[model samples]
Target: MERVEPMPLGGDVARRADAHAAAPLLNCLIREVAQRCPGQGGRRVYRLPGGGRLLRVREGRRPADPEVYTAGAWQRVGHTDLVKLVAEELRRHTGLSNDELPAEMIDSRDAVAALLAARDRVAPPADPYLRSEQSLVTGHPYHPAPKARGGGPVASWLAYAPEAHARFPLVLLAVREDALVEEGDTAALDALGQAPPGYRLLPAHPWQLDLVGGDLAGAFADGRLLRLGTTAFDVWPTAAVRTVHAPAADPAPGADLFLKFSLDVRITNDVRRLWRHDLLKLRRTDTAAAGAIEAQDGPAAWLSDRGYRTAAFAFEELAVLVRDGLGGHVLPGATPLLAAALAEGFDGNPLDGPADPAVWWEAYLRQVVPPVLNAFARHGVVLEAHLQNSLVAVDTGGIPVQALFRDAEGVKLLPDVTRAAGWERLVYCLVVNHLTEVAAALVERHPDHDPWPAARREFARHDVPEIPRLLTSPTLPGKTNLLLRWTGADGADARYLPLPNPLSGP
Candidate 1:
């Protein structure tokens, strides 16, 4: 008779020990497993028997696997039951109650080893996928029951993975209508099997279309089809509306408008409400204040006060849904500012640096600032004024003449919340978030100038003077980052109100 060798503890037990250290729940599970199978390999190393200490467990066969086992099977132990078993075992072995183990012991490696030993005894759970109803819904043909469609000589439709679900499987099928042999046979759903001569079916990658089948359909219907690349889109609604390009054919054109959905609905709603409330407050109380400031100072102050406004458009208002054109104008691509610079470039690169402040100043005075300011003053609203949110379109002279504010959802009103909260939020969004990023980009282009200080001083002199004092001075009840930092012109800092910088050309 052949003798069965005793199973030695597996290497996987150590790995599980390490993993359980990082996860509290896993530790509890291990303890439970040990309690259930007390005879299974279980060992604790206090001091080493040899030169180096070793924690080891003797191998034990599980009833389910018998000879070989997997880590996944061990992980299926119920957490609560595991805890109870470990407590009972501790009482029997140490003559102490379940609660007697120090809190530290629960997190220790020794406890983890004990738990793994216990898990070795329990049988793993049955595969959940085996229980699903759609097991027959394989890469099969879309054959409706007899009453639904043509039964004989039906066309073939290809089924592709639409999305992957750990729990539920889904597939996308593009039925080619042109492939149908029967004419005027709308009722023959099964007639369309294969793709037609001129038509093709394109299915999204499983990873790309994962959790967004409904959203994708809605976007296609609404014609708002720009979406982020796989990585970015998965985490946030940061898509650029554009057409996809095909290698062999002419470039697919895209739309001028872009839409970004909110990842967190609460955050989106908060921003929208904030904008509305600020607009109401500004229209009622700040109109005169803005006008007076503009008159006393200049166009820069005036435009800064007005900001950007939001308009709800009817579906008919949209022009063509140009397919992938936005790829050319995306950020770090051919931005409006860069386009203008290239048109006026002294060298080949558009971002060789502005030729003169006059060109920049004129554009700001004539085009960029005024409309934005006028919009806010007239309509009592402001769009996101941050660097990334606002696009700078230049003209032939390499001057920033136009500003296109994207991400309509990030737009908010000025001076609506309590003074302190409003100022902090505005500064954080505008100066810290937007301006800092833009400054960094410009600095990358213009290595010679300490762009940050210059921009800070310029902002102080032209837009908001009080920023310097706010950053450098003692913290007021709610004031933050107002006096100490160079508000963006240079060294000269002064106390001033919150306003857009005049010289911030685009």
Candidate 2:
């Protein structure tokens, strides 16, 4: 749900869109297929193994300004040409023609262009939390097509896209008590509206309802279901597009509550659905994470996926997950911002301020690292603690006082995954995928600073057996999302590559 993406664009917006799109694409090419070619001056050169052609790009967090050496000199390639070059290179590299990935690359770029065009039109909510949710445009920095919305027309998904800063009410549905199948405490749903006798309230994402509405026509006609109209208050969609933050009802003073619904369409990878299997196991995993965090010493908390409700007939399609929101979990006087939002900045980012780097970085390490390691070592629970799943609540001085983690669907128990496999996932999600991005953002702002040494010390202080090896390892495993997508591997089945260890060296 979170990737380093081009922000709401300005200047020559077309060129901005091209660069933004090309950065992740170029990164994918270099990481998955291209071999490095040394001595290319200010730009780095890589050999496309498929064509044996030399290509160059100015490298940064997001590689940019790409060129291909042709006709005795380097010639720049725009996003269009870059896509063609990547296709040809991949053909030679993998010995397979991937018509799908290439189209997705183009689709991602086009989506960015569309988002750029629409960003200014929709007014972002006054709430900073909502702003962070919609801040990502360059999604999944390593993903080739982070913004490809199932290749549908821009108009199809634009109204629901978080990047567009769109907000709307959920469509209310009343399923007959006989038809409603639910587990856990879904009291939050009943609070949304009153249900007629013999029926229960089920709030659905309007976009998802639009996607699966036709299938439910029979139920509506047969009177098994009834429409209670839309909710009076609008809910802001978060980075995980299907999950929304619904503001508390007026006259009730409390924190916002989160509602996640099944989305049939694919976003980055998997179809966004609350699958039946995951729902069955949700309570155990949520209990593990919740207990682990509660047992810890600090203010760290786990936003439990308290329970789920779904129609018995269309289980996965109609499933809705209720999760705890920021109200009670976040430390008082501290504003909790998405870790992804901190990495991919937004208006009023605490990181974009005057906080001392060492102190801020140390506090961040303390808040984020301990709970993850503790969860894995103490409770044998592996949290997908990547940036999108993390929240850092910063005090008035913009110092992190607590960390809140969510999404039980992504949680893997010790025995569910081999301890070895779970450890790998925890390292990837917590260190490579989450901390590295945050550290890089800090360094980018500080210029001459190195935040990784403190990171090394943080891990070294942990008593877990994995810490020493992690600190000394020559490389850390980084997810190869582009290659994973190209190979059509399940997104949950992560494939990794050895990236140079920043924690071990300068």
Candidate 3:
């Protein structure tokens, strides 16, 4: 096991937390509401459209050190003051009042503080992939409240938080055979724990169980659900928060497996529940995604959502989706790292010390871009290939060799939506959300390196009809996460605003 990186503690946690929370909030405010203004000094400045206030920050990928012009003086705003400013600005901009979002922003900052404190006490996993999966302290770089944990007491969620490097056993349960609702291949669940006669084994996330336990009392009281002991081995939580990865043979006789659970907590946009509607269509979506990736002519792979199981009585509340682990998919001798963690940065990030960044980035685009384009162009499958949903496996020399994508719930099939709509979504997920962040992070490290020309070449390599326009389009769709949350829009209902396309020029 490599030595874990030391994290900030004591007095630094609060100050770091303030910075961590402010960056994303500032990003949202600047992107959604603030109009770019002429900078006075080296710092970047923007004028708030609604409040008519001047805001300035030390600009980079994640903007920081926010200050507002007040009474002829630029006064620095801390996390709390920033939240108030955002809420006021948003309320005036949208002509809508939202008290929930501001509270969530505050909660998200508190969560970061708690995560930093907890992380200081634990050792990170030895596996680079697991470390990468658990390393998102400042999540969703553009969301208003990326780390909010349902605005609950910290103690309630801390033990299960991925950012705090938490790993715990699943609470095993048994649903009566007649009451068991399942689809696809869930044979793996039986290996986790034993079920009594006439009942099938089901694994439940402890946090989800706690949130929905009241509604499940009837099943427990009756013969519908029975309590089985917890799993013998602890599973590591991924950045998704609700999903956990059980190490190979941790409980014996099986490879590593990812288990996605019904988390009632609202992590970023919506309550992270395995809704019945999504679950019902899981097999169809998973099948399409798996088939699409399998057909692609590269090392790209899809971590198939094999199956799910839950008590029929509490379907969405107790559901757990079993996903393919990295054992078979990732090339041997290559370590798979979460793409988001690469962008966010971790202790052993290969992106940190690339000798030839252009070569490394070209290799990255080769592995990442084609599979997504092929999936959409050939198989009519739209993968949510954003940072979190993507993983890049690198060889010993830290060159990306393979790309893997996951999350069946986010996959959209063509003809179900118009070709134009699918193309738009593909552009947003593949280009705006995924590549742009990675490119910016690369540029941040290697100031002289330009990633877009290689990206343009990579896009030009593909025969997809949208490639020409994608390279020539002046603006790309940037999801309006701030406006969506403020207006109480559905999390799945994505609204986009135009963002300048670097690929469009040159």
| Candidates 1 and 3, the one with greater lDDT | 3
Q: How many clashes show up per model?
A: 46, 2, 0
lDDT of 1 by residue, 99-181 (tens): 41222223233333333443354321121111111111110110001011111111110111000111111122232323212
Candidate 1, run of 10 with poorest lDDT: 139-148
Model 3 lDDT tens row, 1-506: 11123344577899999999999999998888899988878899999989789999998989999999999999999999999999899888989999899999999998999899888778888889999999999999999999999988887888888898888888989999999889999988898878999999989988888898899888999879988878888888899999999878575644399999998888889889999999999999999999999986788999999988987788889899999988889898999999999889999999888989999999999999999999999999999999999999999999999999999999999898889999899899989989999999999899999999999999998899888888899999999999999999997998899999989866
List model 2 lDDT by residue over 339-457, tens digit each.
99898889978888945899999999999999999988999999999999999988888888899999999998989789989998998899888998899889889987789889988
Q: Specify the highest-lDDT model's number.
A: 3
lDDT of 3 at 356: 93
Query: Which is the better candidate, 1 or 2, if ranked by TM-score?
Result: 2
lDDT of each: 0.29, 0.84, 0.90
Error of 2 at 339 (Å): 0.6
Tell how far residue 314 is off in model 1, in angstroms. 22
Total clashes for model 1: 46
TM-score, candidate number 3: 0.97
Residue 89 of model 3 has an lDDT of: 90
TM-score of each prediction: 0.31, 0.95, 0.97
Give the poorly placed runs of model 2, Cα more than 4 Å off.
Answer: 1-11, 249-255
